[model samples]
Structures are given as C-alpha cells and as structure tokens.
Target: MILAALAALNVALAGPWPALAGSEDVVVEGAWARASVGTSRPGAAYMTLRNTGNEAVTLTGIMTPIAMMPEIHRSTTNDKGVSTMAPAGEITIAPGESVAMAPGGLHAMLMRLQEPMNEGESFPLTLTFSGGGKVIIEVPILKLGARGPEG
Candidate 1:
C-alpha cells in the first residue's frame, strides 16, 4: 500500500510519467512533443534512442493513451522544396548506436488525439522493441514548432 501510494505520488508530482524499466537495454532521452494547434490536428513527438546492449534491436511499436493511433513516420522534401510525411517502418538500432527523432525528419505521429496537446503539459508513451524490451517515457509538450527541449 505504501509503495502504491508512493508511485501515485510520483506520477502526480512528475507529470504522471511511469518509472523506466531498469532492465531494458534501450535508453530514451529528450522525449518531447509539440503543442497541437487544435484537437483536430495531429501532433508529433521526438526523442533519442540509444542501444546499450551488445545486440541489435528493432523498435516495433508505440503506444500512448493521448492518441488513438501512434505511428512511426519520416519527413522528406522534394527537389522543389515540398515536404511530405510518410509512414516509416520499424527502426533498428545496432549495438552502441543511437537514433534521433527530430522535426522535419523522423518522428512519432499522434493521430486522433484525445485532446489538444498544450504547452506545459506532458503525456506518457511506451516504445516496444523486438526482443520484448520496452521503455516507458514521458514526452513533454513544448511550444508549437519548437525545435528542441530548450524552447
């Protein structure tokens, strides 16, 4: 009972983020998202993933309560400077390698958001890996179109 209460307190005070599973070999850093213009518009999240283990692992899925569907996506610009976003398949990280998700590049798409993602707010997201390892991260909502966590 005390442990449960402490856990609840931790979330309540720390943006409702779950503690990271220490056993997971993959580490997530600088997880954040942009504030949604409106509830009708989808939002995007970014982060950096580093593989600490000695083997390669594929990031297979993303799950979040704030959005009805979350997907992996990549953004590319044509020669004419028209950029398009498309679904990106699973991402693989080799041992001691790192992957970064940034705006106008690779990112996580939040479709059918439950509500507008406002600045100063945050949400939880779980990333699943091929070897059954999972990392639960809290993504803070930054200013609309913000580049990084500092903004």
Candidate 2:
C-alpha cells in the first residue's frame, strides 16, 4: 500500500520535472525577449539550458553580436524586500543533471545593447562551456509573455 501511494505521488510530481541534456549538448529553446515597445536601450533574453555530459561543466561566458558583454546573471532577494539581478561568475551543471535558465531565475543578461531587440527576430549567441566547448545558437527573440510549449 505504501509503495503504491509513493508511486502515485511520483507520477504527480513528474509532470513539472525538467528534461536532461547531454554534456556536449547545448539546447536553446523557447528564447524570448520582453515586448515593451518603443524605448529599448537594454533587454534580457531567457531560455532553458540542459547539459548532459560525463563531466561537470560550468557556463563561464557568453558572446553576442549585438551586445558588448553577455554575462550570466541570477535574480536574488534581499532583506529589504527588493529583488536584484547580480552577475554570476559561473553556473555548474553536474554530470547527468540539467540546468534551467529561464525568467524569474538564472538568465543571460544582455548589456550594452548596440541595437533594439524586436519580436520574432533571431540573434546569434555563443555560450562557452567550462570544458572548452562552445555552443553557437540562434536565439529567437519573442514577446515577454511567450512561454515554451509544454511536453
């Protein structure tokens, strides 16, 4: 009876579980940018990252054609009830596990924007893994409210 109940509970929680990706694997899906029309000096991009490699890897740096510096950033809460985005030195993805970089969490902070980011446009992005492998991806800029399709 206990075992059966545990199985049922697992099934319920599994619905929201994250998918795993390989070590040499770098997948940038559901990439989107905020859609606040007109004024756009700086904007952020969000996506999900899965690393399925035998060895642990860290996301060390980023490169983009439009931005001067593309850095890894995470959102944190302070004691004053204020939220701030801080620069992350590196993000480690353990072997056989995955990392998700999405809105309200870890994300790529595109700073020193050279041009305005519009919806439905794709941009070139290069993510450097700690193990010396670089993944070049074409990230589609989408509206802020857009979300990845549920599997």
lDDT of 1 by residue, 59-92 (tens): 9889999999999999999999999999999898
> Cα miss at 50, model 2 (Å)?
1.2
User: Model 2, residue 52: what's the lDDT?
Assistant: 55
Q: Tell me the TM-score of each prediction against the true structure.
A: 0.83, 0.72
What CA RMSD would you report for each candidate? 6.2, 14.7
**Mind giving the per-residue lDDT tens digits that candidate 2 earns over 1-151?**
9999999997786555333322356555665565434434556777777655566667788899878877888988789978888888888877666677776678888888877777777788888766556677877777655654321
Report lDDT (Cα) of residue 127, candidate 2: 86
| Over 4 Å off, model 1 | 1-23
TM-score of 1: 0.83
Q: In lDDT terms, how accurate is model 2?
A: 0.70
Question: By how many angstroms RMSD does model 1 differ from the true structure?
Answer: 6.2
lDDT for model 1, on a 0 to 1 scale? 0.86
On the 0 to 100 scale, the lDDT of residue 137 in model 2 is 80
Q: Which candidate ranks first by lDDT, i.e. highest?
A: 1
Candidate 2: segments with Cα more than 4 A from true spot: 1-23, 35-40, 144-151
